[model samples]
Structures are given as structure tokens and as C-alpha cells.
Target: MPPLRPELQAAHDEMDETGQDYAFAVCPTWQGDAWEVNTKEVNIYSALSGTFKSHAEATAAGTAWLLGV
Candidate 1:
């Protein structure tokens, strides 16, 4: 696997520290398909891509971040 970027590492750290699921999704207010940060995971198909992910790890993790793994 490629080395994770610092920002990606930081995001994972923040997710772990806060016990919240972090995911990438389309910016609701933005006018494009590009993804942005999001907390809700109920219906996040907008995540065109994923940087990191976990599943069934914890309930407080904002969204399960199931990277199909």
C-alpha cells in the first residue's frame, strides 16, 4: 500500500481519539461531485473514494466506515 499522507493519518487519529466514525462525502452545499468531510453515515453514497475505514468497531464512531472490508 502507498504511504498514508499526514492529513489522512490525522483524520484517522481524530476518529480514533473521538470514538467517532469519520467519512468522506460530497459537499452538500458545494456545486460539484468532489467529496468533503462528513459525520453522518446513514446514507453516504457520496463518498466517491475512501482514505481509511473500519467496521463494527464501535457505536460512537460517527459512521461504521465500512470500506467494504
Candidate 2:
């Protein structure tokens, strides 16, 4: 896999601080051309939430959730 986007990396790092293992990846949507950042536990099969258009959005949302912001 390619290196994760910086925002994603930051989110991962933030998650790590909480002892939650999560993954951030770009996934193709059922809409064909649409793609999103898929956030989930590292070894989980389902996504924790809906996808975001870019890594930064995904990271921001995930980070906020984690921080209860």
C-alpha cells in the first residue's frame, strides 16, 4: 500500500494514543468513480462510519470523535 496521507497518519497517531487500533484507507465506492476514506479497526471488517471525500476530512472527523469534540 502507498504511504498514508499526512492527515491520516495524524489520525492514526492520535488513535494510538488512546490505545484504539484503527485503519485509514482509500476505498472505491459502489458509485464507481466515487472514493472515500474508510475508517475502521485495524482488523475489523466493517467501517466505523461513512466515508469522507479526502483524508483530511476523514482524519478531522475521526479525531473529533475520538476526542469527543
Candidate 3:
């Protein structure tokens, strides 16, 4: 993975800390020598959407979207 800019990293980190109501779904997949940041809304790990506000939020959203509700 490439290095993220300091500002970008700060924004993301801030979002993470206070963004508990935010969705952050990350599916780590090993393709060969690197891990791919798979889709957050859909994929094998599509179990995350909007559940916990963070990962929970994502999961809830995923389930809901999957159910078409």
C-alpha cells in the first residue's frame, strides 16, 4: 500500500475516532504478496453496510441492502 498523506491520514483517523456512527468495512484479501482492500459495501465480506456506526453500521447497511429493504 502507498503512504497516505498526513492530512488524509488525520482526516481518516479523526473520522475513525469520532465516526463511530460512520461505516468502515474492510475486507482483507491476499492475492499474492499483497492484501487487497476489497469492497466495503459489497463482496464476499458484504456483511458490512450500516450496522455499528463503524463496522456495525456497515454491517447493518450491508444486510439491509442485501435484503433489498
Candidate 4:
């Protein structure tokens, strides 16, 4: 979705190579066409408080963050 940020993509790729169990949580942002890992309903406190261009991007980035990759 919107081509995941390079770092997140790299992290995801690395996780794939490392055979790590990683999953992402994605939810819509207050604004349409955007998604985020952190939201008012879910208190995910970390550096991944980024507004992604789409749900897929947000989910991938959140997975990378959760894996600390």
C-alpha cells in the first residue's frame, strides 16, 4: 500500500530472512485514506506513531515495529 517506507520494507524483509514471527495491527486514521498503528482506542506507545498512506503500509510498518526490526 503506497509502497511501504524503505526502512519498514527492509525490516520486513529481514524478518522474513530471519524466520521471525511478526504480525501487524492496522486501524484507520481519523482521516480517510490513511492508517496508523497507534490510535485513540489502542494505546500503542512507541516510535511507530506514523500516519501511513494506506492500510497495507500501516500494517507492514507496524509489523516491523512490533518485531523491533
Give the C-alpha lDDT of model 2.
0.53
> On a 0 to 1 TM-score scale, where does candidate 2 land against the true structure?
0.36
Candidate 3 structure quality by residue, lDDT tens digits, 1-69: 897545344434544554344323332222222222212221122222222324344445544554553
Q: Which stretches of candidate 2 lie over 4 Å from their true place?
A: 1-46
lDDT of each: 0.36, 0.53, 0.36, 0.54
Cα lDDT tens digits, model 2, 6-28, are 64565456545555465444444
Q: Which ten contiguous residues of candidate 4 have the minimum total lDDT?
A: 38-47
lDDT of 4 by residue, 7-69 (tens): 445444544554434434455554556766641113222335668887778877876666664
TM-score of each: 0.32, 0.36, 0.30, 0.46
Angstrom error of the Cα, residue 15, model 1: value is 0.5
Model 1, range 1-69, lDDT digits (tens) per residue?
A: 896455445544544555434353223223333233434343322233332232222222323344531
